[model samples]
Target: MGNILNSVILESILLDEGETLYKQNEASAYDLADDNGYAYHKVAAWVKGKDGTKYIKTASIASRAQLGKVNVSVTGKGAAGLYEIDSEFYTVGENVPDPESIRNNSYCYSEVNNVLVSNAIYRSGFANLDFRLSTGLPLKQYFNNDGELNEATIQKVKNSLKPLAKTAVSENPPIMREHLIYAESLSAFVDWMVDENGEMVNKVSNGVLVVDVGGGTTDISFINSANEIYMPGSDTVKTGVLDVFKKLKQYLSSAYEIDEEHIRVDMLDKALRTNKFTVRGESKDCEGLCNKAKQHVAKRLNNFIDELVTTTLDHIIFVGGGAEALREQLL
Candidate 1:
């Protein structure tokens, strides 16, 4: 039996509610389910296969158990017997077993014995192929650095994306190179938009400005009427959304003259839930502290935007995690 293992790294924030989220989640989860009928249909479409021939069987297995049961919904002839399966799942957490360790022979045979037994169907003496459609192995495993994804790493990831094929193996060349090119261009555009000095570049011929603000970096780029795009630079700053909480901590410490480490989680939770930073004790600086943090964030965003607009001639388009949150301040 041949088995294919496909994996995708999804951001938690992207899973927020609504139709877009549902569709994305479903698409990602569908790759792990057994779709023998679907595969046969595809074969039938492309070739003159025999009516009863069992050409291919596709199955999707998720690495995370918390995603819940796998629901196989079939239409046409296969719809009558669709069912669910409680498959074995695994994830790499703070202290969890490393996925690369298994493939690299770093893991002891005994350590993965349970995983092997539980996923025997996948481990059986057949072609065991690992598929990363969008990126290479986890970012941490691919890069030796400690920080998040960088421009160079993004480029590497774009280059590593596999093509859409029934089966993929390390030895096989990518089935579609265009997908890689598209992904690379998109990633490059994003990287150019967030780089601190990216605005210095002239412009692309398309005449569209791109701005990207991510957790670890911000990039700005401009495309001119001549269809030439240019990037001045990017900012690799530590001031992300998470920094807001850190700034809140510092603000509380200075205003209340209290040890931030001793602050209760409940208080922090309340602040986040209410969207209002509050202190229990009689501290007149509580409001001021909150304002200061907000001001700092606003200042950084303003500076980045000011530089980006001043250096470019194209209309602005913002994309990224931080950009979404700063929409109010941006206007």
Candidate 2:
């Protein structure tokens, strides 16, 4: 067993819908280093005159080509009565060109699988690697009914991922073995109670409520002093940071009469943070627009939080990407 262990590398991957995070066995246990997680995106551009052309390109951060493979497929209409070819790829730090493209059922599987294999291989020093991965599902997604993960649904997710894992692993020099993916939260409860060592931070006989604002959804639940995970019970709202971005996109599209694709994710963020932004050398201000959108989302969140009367609680916690954004408004 020792020899076998030495022969193959072990890796734990957090397969987030919005991001992919992983840590290798060589790293200290529970230590998430800076290089661990990555934003998920694939920027594939169609090559003109190419039909069904596909190739995976790898590169280091210092090198330009690390964006993975460029896949060319005959899709949509082309210029001047010719069938057009389309390709998509992604680079780190760049806003996703089309959020809907990745959110749908058809295009996402390949993107996730390719990135998983590419990232694993990159970490393994381009060697054939056997990976044991760990991932999380949204509390509401896996436990939609009765606040518990359904057995059949869990099995379905696992089974669907297995083949994707195999295909990704085999694509590069590193091949993956078996892997594991699971799902977390109660943000304040996570920090205040759960320690890095998986031990309790403090023992108390009090109830705590946790609210986590995420990218696509916000989850709410409760935990008692006895460490029993309870809820109002647990529930989720469909409002999140992405929703805000979508609304901003809509506003920009209507106001400027520009194609929605031209509005990058970063642009929305910039417009929100700084009231003014420029397009084609023209400066525009969107303070009123962004404020209205923020107010709309805040109202939804406020309504959800208002329904919480689940047992008297000693504390309440708010966390996740959307938490900070809504903090002042929520308070």
Report the number of the highest-TM-score candidate.
Answer: 2
lDDT of 1 at 33: 17
Top lDDT hit:
2
lDDT of 1 by residue, 1-331 (tens): 0112322222111121221111123223211211111001010011112343322232222221112222222432221111112232332111121222222212212222222212322321121223211211222222234434445544543433222111111232223212111211234454544654445453444456555544333444455555444344323333443444457777777766778876543344335335555456542425455556656775786676676555534456665444654555553
Where in model 2 is the C-alpha error above 4 Å? 1-93, 101-129, 163-178, 186-188, 203-206, 254-261, 273-276, 283-288
C-alpha RMSD values across all candidates: 15.1, 12.2
Instruction: Give the per-residue lDDT of model 2 (tens digit) for 1-331.
Output: 2332232333222221222222334442221111111222111111112333333222222101123333222452211111111233332222333322222222212344334434443433323434443434456655656666655555654554444322121332333454343433643566687775678766546677677776566777767767766645567776776677788788888887888878877677678768776777898988877777777787888778778644666777887657766676664
TM-score (C-alpha) between model 2 and the true structure: 0.61
Worst 10 residues of 1 by lDDT: 37-46
Error of 2 at 81 (Å): 30
RMSD of 1: 15.1
Our tally of clashes for model 2 stands at 15
lDDT of each: 0.35, 0.49
